[model samples]
Target: MQGLKAVLPLLIFVFCVRAKKMRWCTVSDPEHKKCAELAKALVAVLPPAAVAAFARLSCIRASSTTDCIEKIRANRADIVTLDAGEIYSAVKQFGLVVVAKEIYSDGGCILSVAVVRNSSVDIRSLQGHRSCHSGARWTAGWSLPLGFLLSRNYLSWSKEQLLSQDVSTFFSGSCIPGAAAMAPALCTLCQGQKSYIRQKNYHCETSHSEPFYNSQGALRCLRSGTGDVAFVDHLALESIEGSDRDQFRLLCTDGTQAPISHYRTCNLGRGPGAGMVTRANFRKTARKFLTTAQTLFGPRGRERQRFQLFNSSSFGENDLLFKDVTDKLFVLPDDMDVSQVLGLDYVALLKGLGHEGSSLEDSVVRWCCISYAEQKKCEQWALSIKSDPLVCVRAVSMRECIEKIKRDEVDAVSLDATHTFIAGRCGLVPVVTEYYEKERKCVPAEGSTHLETDVLPSVVAVAVAKRSSRSIFIGNLGGRRSCHGHMYSPAGWLLPYRHTLSLEHNSSSPCDPDQVYNSVFWKGCLPGSQGNLCKVCMGGTGEAATKRCADNHNERYYGNMGALRCLVGDPSGKSFGDVAFLEQHNLQANILSLSSTGWADGWTASEFELLCGDGRRAPLSEWESCNLGIVPPNTVMTRPVLTARVYDFLMKSQETLAANPNTEFKLFESQQYGESDLLFKDATQCFVHTSHMTARSILGGEFYSHIESVFNCTHSDILEFCNQDICSIFE
Candidate 1:
């Protein structure tokens, strides 16, 4: 067993050496085997730890570019290899830094075209044929070839003329392979070396296309194809030497003269490359990583060859590239302009911002604008600020406009104080303020203004469903409810009730019970008020019952004063003793309970006067009538006794008084006697004095007006009464 172990070690060593030699042959020239051996020896002399570290850091072993990126992100690798085309996309999307280029591999741009060989279809003759490229319609493959051909005057056609010729075009994932596999035999344009290598088995032809270069023998092989025309790299043409190559020729060159080519020089000006982007909050971290990479690789020739780092220039380059491709491809319609495309005003260009929700059509228009700007302005401005304008000009409603401004939908908006106030109330910021004297309007904003005075004021109302009790109530109650007066009169009536009720029930009255009842009574009096009555009634069995009593009294006293007064009157059979007995017991038999709780809880004269006064003197208008009518403290009252004849007389008198145009009622009176003795009265005296004055002047002409004004004043007075104790009620 020991001998076999030793032999196994030797065999393993021999196998490893053979494997190493095979690996060397795959990457190095076979004739330079000795050089390969020396290279291997030099590699071996390095520290074992360094060798392992290099292996660990290299990204060559990753399965794909995506995997390589992941390894780098995970801190498992530091060196990655990617196709030249992938570099821009990676840097723009992921903020990846390029470190080095592989030695001995000379890489340059190439253009490839698929065509039939030994045919008479020159570049000009094939103008209307379908074409394919390995990219979206708005990309370099589609645009570069067309730009090159047009600049050279190869077809003597305008872009519109070419499009009108019905030259069908498509973007495919694999241009060469797709062209070869197309159903109707369409030609394609692609990278020269890649296409030639991929379609080596197919008989295809190519031309040394202008505006680009290639060094592979792409033109030679493409010239031998069955198609009469093709796209080929300019550099590849220098290496062609066969009969197949002779059959093909240079259609044009981009000013760098080649034999038989006469194309205008293309200004391949320098622009910013794609941006190194990362998550917004991670920008600082990304910047750090990039800086570290630059420090390590910049002086080592990697900076010039592998990276073009600029802080603000990155996004601009991508925008320019997008614009160029979009313009050449004619993806957007010709009639549309920049404003229509980006939906923005020209001011956006100054502000360096873009709009959202733009379509491909809009994208094309923006592309044209950018193209024009680049040609005229020397491409100095950052393209990042340029975008489709159609999205900016869409008309929006006042509410929507306000909402969008608050949400940062547009950078700014011209709005009124109301809109600004609403937005501010909703936690939106207003950055500027503007005023338009011609339109007599003021807008709040900081920068450029776009006034849309044509917009109407948005409707402002508390909306309720048609079926809602609140809606019906508001409709029936004159649609204009006042908060002050209606709240107090009922409360004025209820304060006495609560005091009396508290004495009778031997318990403290519920807080604000009178106010609650007043609210319920007023709400229930409106049309369709039945629907909402349950809110107050649901809790009426306990504390709510007391509230209901106060509410009933308030309704009778304010809304139906005549009915309340009648309910307290006596019948013919009722004697004064019977009325007095009922009043003493606080019974409801002889007297109509003006309130739901009977006479014991009825409003008192002193209470009414107190409510009407400024808390110092009795009310000056109806004070005498109220005081004379008041029962003693703790005395229960019933309906007063009266004969049928007397009742009829009172009714007739009231009706006659109401009918007279000169009739009026006093609301208050002031003492005209002593200086030290100041006396105030109530509504009765006030109305009586006003009535006498009106009668002495022109009679009843002002009677209705006087009544209305007095009623209004009374309501105001009630509100003032309640206002004093409202805070205490809530407390």
Candidate 2:
């Protein structure tokens, strides 16, 4: 029975599916003394029944680490171990996920240190001494430490310095194998023939024959006095003669000396330990396989051989698929995806080192806001994104935010599709579509009326007027008081501006509709516009003057509701405005709610009319026949230069907010502010991704062309007034 029990776990992989099984690939060199033995011992050490319920394990051998990645992608192998650097490569190039990580007995992360003989040198004063490094472009040896130095402006670096170079010229002489193709000043002390080339026994070559090449090799260089300081990882110290510990000291980032164990604060950076990689789609199965395998054959397992699932020594190469200091495997958090765990800073560092994710420099993305409400929500969002940060920079208005993006002062903003066209003209791109769930009557399979799961109906842009108005005809609309949601809004301003420009008015009247409107509207509440147009605008003032006219509940007359409020003039005074321009959605939301104002106090169903094209008025329900054109939903925008980061930020922020909807603070609507939407429409439920669509495709193409034709008809500079982007700003 004991024998059967032992054999059950061993056959776990073999018996699962029917007791299906999975294959794990290991990079192996037959010539290496421990390679084959380690692989065999691992399988032999498994307690038979450990993985019987879910997975069975099998090992496939590969010639090298890179080969193992290929095998994994080909589906011939499902898992392998990889360093933090290699993990970035596997994720970006091969789409692999990290299932488990190595945890040393001391801690999970390894420290990088600058090692020097006692009383020999100070980190701040090692200007011309000989130095040794593990290798060029490696995390501990180059990227981490050099990145730290470069960030502090301590070294002069060329464009691709970190990846293609050897070292800073502060080192008089050094041995870095890969420098053969880059900085010659760095290889001045190498034993390589002629300071270049990779011939056998070449002095600076990465071969074991090199005096200084890797962690072990760099330490050897220090011991032999070939270099004054050795830049190596923490694991190197354990291999040094114990008695010699007193002779060496580590240089801390603060420029003080410390003992090795104090490395946590003294080190250049943490060498994020290696992890097991498999296709992200197969991560669940892969995680199960690793957890069970480690349970039986790992260092603390019940098996006699005590095979280590993540042992670096198994490769007999100091560093191969995994590092040697690993004492156990740590399953990564279930919710932590590879990119989240790998981190953007590290990814950006790796990009400089010529690894993957180079297209996106890992950095905190900055978002631009034009209102206090948006700024408030941005702060909450910044706090929610604990893994990566979102920074909010303020702009006076939507146009200012778009201009800031053009100037590279900010990274992103959310805009209505009408404004999206303006932003795209300023070189911004669209990242996602903000979809508002519209209320539509539908009948499901059971024949019961219900709302569709996902539906955002198109909005109608309309012109509203009082039934008593008799003289304000469409063509003669020139000098009438006008109420608009905002300057560039499709419903409130842009559409009307364009429609007015498409007419042949009195030659004596201003040809420019924009100028004509400014002169015509004796009383105006053009939210985001300037001057007399802002008179009735209700919002805080300052450099936020235009923002005060923002299209939200804040502005006295803003958005569709605000525009309606403008039309709801005081009963005792002249009607607020002769006409109001806004969307039907806003009109729909406020039909029955008239609490704050007395202008529309007794507005009966028969009193509201839709202003028409021929200077005539139509019934309220006939808005389609008298309305301006419809526009697409609002979009999230960024510059072409920042598409990746902005996309990631919006997608992640949306997901985070969507996941915890019950929170007091939310990303979409400001319930506390009593605003339907601030930065984005309160109507938005989710942001839909249009796989290959772009800003131009969504907004500028037909919309801009139509606006251009309209403005041309009136010989109006309305296009110029709104800065309508008909062509690429770059052009």
Candidate 3:
């Protein structure tokens, strides 16, 4: 018995040693030796608890995807972290599973343009100027900024265009491989070297070390005049501040609305950002671990920690890694018909929600037919039951529609909210509303009754041109003279004094109609005149005129009249864009200006500011006001009823307006001769024809066509057969 006990203790020791060696072997590889060293360095800097947790967890070390795959094949590791771009490449090459992801909020890159402060180089004026970038791989560092410049025609790739024309280009390898590297880099760079000198700060410095070196080196090179401009990330600049702080200035930056980088842009398949991946054999296990780990290390978990080592600030609490990955994963089907049947219009829906359009139509059609049928049905029902009544309503013409509404034809009309508000006054009402279900109440429309849904309250308001004479009088008194004079007046006030005969002995008596009328009605009958006109002209002209008019008439008229000259002044002072001018003065103001300008100056700017009560001028942004309040234009992009083509047409109209030099376009509306009903009939026919096919069926056909364009299919086509079935079912 004593001998057996001794043997058991020896066996237990051997097992423990084997387990320790196995754990080390799983992560230690010749190719990943550097990564292992990096991991160890990271561990040394981590808090005691984090270090303990990391030690307990398995480590995955690999140089390339192939090496990672090989280790996984031997059951070495389960989880792998990589840059999103690299992962895409690796997955495409090796068919690996991506179980988790870490998306950067602003395109996973940090691009900055370094220029000498007070240099003649305006960041925008640097178009075609010699620029050195840190290569395309550094997405935030270079690619995104370059792409933005290219899109804006600020940078050109043509050698001929660049030659002798202030264009030069260079790329230096700077920035780290992933966002994990960038986070620490950003902290270190902003906080400075002094903050990172301590033992606790070493982890951040090491994590950001690569970016620091690249940024520091690049800035030094730029300062030395090796390049005209340097495009890099924040870390690079931060690293070299002590040496070249005074010499360099950030000319432009991504994710800021400053003058230097007013509009930053991004694209797919480039830049440094971490992503999640799992071993093919251990995907399920990896996913489970990630899910569990996220719960333990998520926002709630960090909230419980007295002092968080990773996320000291709340910024990382909602980082893409934890939020996006934790949400549901939707895998689109390979078979177009299947996707359609399942209602997967993933791309189209995104586009509808204001994303740039891709080939989302098929997906949208499928989703419309299948997945979103109930929602669509509800929307259609609500629209059908709307109380306001949807009809083919029009004003005199397109321009008149804008103008007459400004003139106050009816209370309000339902059109594209963007268009109406873009062209209408600020208080125009929106017909449809939108809201999140959890946040608000939704009232469904009953048949033939327009029910207001509280789910989405109209962000826009409806306004009518002042109607009451009192209101108009007050409005006019308040300096809206043009509106008052054009819309209001009393008739027959001067008729009685038309033929007043005045008898003067010396000269032929000239009868003054206005004077006679004012005298009789306004002046008290003092009775001094010759012949029949004597009785009519009872009092003096000034006193009679004053009493004859309405109590507030003079006040209203003079007050409004005073504003006419101001209104006629140049409307283009504010530099407020197109829509502003349209909404403020309404269509009439612009029309009058057009007519007056044509008569006087021959041109009027689209948007202009007019002087108001104070010395300060309020911007007359009619176009902006109209656009902001309009519904169709604002909501059309998201509406299912408006087809992609229709939405495109509307957007193109706005673009055309913006691009036109005069900021004005003549819209001619006319009926087809002898075919007034033709338009309606044709539209109805098309609607009926399209309605016969289910969304899925339409998608199936579209997908088949797309596939046929790409690859010749010899096998019996599944999409074509499914299309018929879908059509029949929908019909």
Candidate 4:
């Protein structure tokens, strides 16, 4: 037994040595044959020292590129070459690593282009034209051309049907490989293998069995009068020899044509070329193998008489193991990943083409609504706009909406100044500020003088009280009942008690804002508050009464309008709330609306008076001077990546609404829903793109300082959660 144990370690080492084989995956039978030839050629040419560093070479056949990706991920295969689009899937979905990329004579990128026999047909009006594509889902042939056409509104599609079906209908006929089952009409012009007895059934396949399978075959399809146009990359145009190549013209997006060589000016888009990928840890081994292959059979190699790495014409195929146009194999940086290899623009192009798997959501701007009333208004507004699709997503509170934006469950939400600050901290950026002024944009012009009506596009926080409340002033309101919009509200909660609590000065008590409000007020209606803080809060009416003291519109005392209703002594004759703290932007309109809506039977703007911070009383019109602070206006907030799209959608929707006045729904007006300021402030007139303005910059220095005074005292749940390490990635 001791003698056998000594040989056990040696046996295991021998077994491991025998198991070390590097397998190259191929998608087609022709590709498999070419790979086997290349493997044999490498062994015959490599020196002993160089060959010792690599394992024995072998070939594995896969049904398709996707199958190859799966095999490599499962350790059944070790290396493979794929185009940029398939490389995106291999890395993003299967966690494969790109080790090297093909560099052409021009660059390491391919320009997608459309080729035609003549310049007779306009590119934009190809509704009934016959088309030829290299292969279904290929970058240049399908994704870039279709995506560019869709973006330019040259073709129409809906999420309900497959994009393949739409393309089949758009074209009279086509020869798109790998689309035999998805859209059979797309393969009507495809000529399958009819001469070979073993592969006669091959029809619309992504292999060389189908005569019109790849870019070279697609070019033949166009040249044979079987297809009107061929969609391919610049490499295909450059590879074709003879005077027939001059017969093809490049189709530009501007309804013009150029020579086939003018792809730089008349192309769809540029994308990365095919690349070699393997497991991350196996990158070095894969790199060594490819380096030896390139040195042996590359364009400048001495072994070109026996084998050629880039050319597959000897195997009766094109681009078998590597692209035929590959000039050399370039090793990527060790730290470079797929995104870096594809470039940001190419990655975004793939994402826009639905390669990221959320194309429907990417097409529309989903507005986040916080209440039933706001959702209803948003729905109406969505139905009214047609320039850009609008969808509504519901959340229970403003903070929930911001969280939803961060999680990508929703797109954008209109947030007040305080909530905007919190949303900014969570990686949501301001797209556009709600414009209230009539004449100018939010940011003043460079040389233009400030007009008399220029107010910097903001709302003023005002402390309002009934004229009959003679004893209730700002300084002597310790034991009085107060009406607040909601917990953590800027005007209702923060500004109202900014001076009284003096939380910034206190350090021993943990500076809890909730405890401060609970201690000062006797009993009041502060929505989202529990215990005595919500004692006077009137819940929703009818079926919604179960939502009493809720944080949303279900609570009767929830927002600016709700706070005003609370101070008006509630329609139920409950005289609990005394002083109302809210924004002064929609104050007069909300009060005037109360008389017609019957929420308050006799409430008028004249019945309320503004209370200054210095214990002086003034009329409601003097809010500009007697206000606590000038808070930034509500701004549309969305994810940083979505800021530009959201802004474009909003601007287009606003322009549509302005051009058609008779439209049933309004963007800024929400009083028609029996509530004031549902999705946005009722006083807003337009929208101003904030450009690169953040919440802090938009709020200016003074108001941001006041905001600091409020939140610096206490840490809320939002701050605690968003301040974690995970949130830093989004920021």
Quick one: best lDDT, which candidate? 4
Q: For model 4, state the Cα shift of residue 348 in Å.
A: 12
Against the reference, the lDDT scores of all candidates come to: 0.25, 0.62, 0.29, 0.76
Those runs of model 2 whose alpha carbons end farther than 4 Å from true positions after fitting are: 1-15, 18-33, 42-79, 125-128, 160-163, 166-214, 279-289, 304-321, 332-336, 352-731
Q: Which runs in model 3 stand beyond 4 Å of their true positions?
A: 1-34, 37-122, 125-137, 156-227, 253-731
Per-model TM values vs. the true structure: 0.25, 0.45, 0.31, 0.56
| TM-score comparison, 1 vs 3, better candidate | 3
Q: In terms of TM-score, how similar is model 3 to the real structure?
A: 0.31
Write the residue-wise lDDT of candidate 4 on 1-731 in tens digits.
35435533543443244335688998677888998888777666554433443337889977656667888999999999887777887888788999988888877888889999967977888889999998877878887788667655567666467778889999999999877767889999999854343234556776666778778889989989999999987898867778877888989988899988788989986667778889887787687667757765889755777799999998878888888988889877788756567764456556655566766677788889877788888998888877568889988888888877766678789888888888877756777787787665433367732111224477888999999888878766766788889877888877766655332333244345566667677788888778988988888876344466787787878888889888886777675588888889889988988788887788778888999988788999898889887777888887654665676688778778888998878877878877777888887877766735667887777877777776777767876655543101111
Model 1: runs farther than 4 Å from truth?
1-49, 55-85, 93-143, 146-174, 177-221, 226-228, 241-247, 253-731
lDDT of 3 at 559: 12
What is the lDDT, from 0 to 100, of the residue 615 in candidate 4? 79
Please report the candidate that would top TM-score against the real structure.
4
lDDT of candidate 1 over 417-478, digit per residue (tens): 22232333332332212211233423323562222223222111111111112222211222
lDDT of 2 by residue, 564-633 (tens): 7678753454437878888775564464444433335656647778877656778878877777777667
TM-score for candidate 2, residues paired by index: 0.45
Q: What is the lDDT of residue 483 in candidate 3?
A: 16
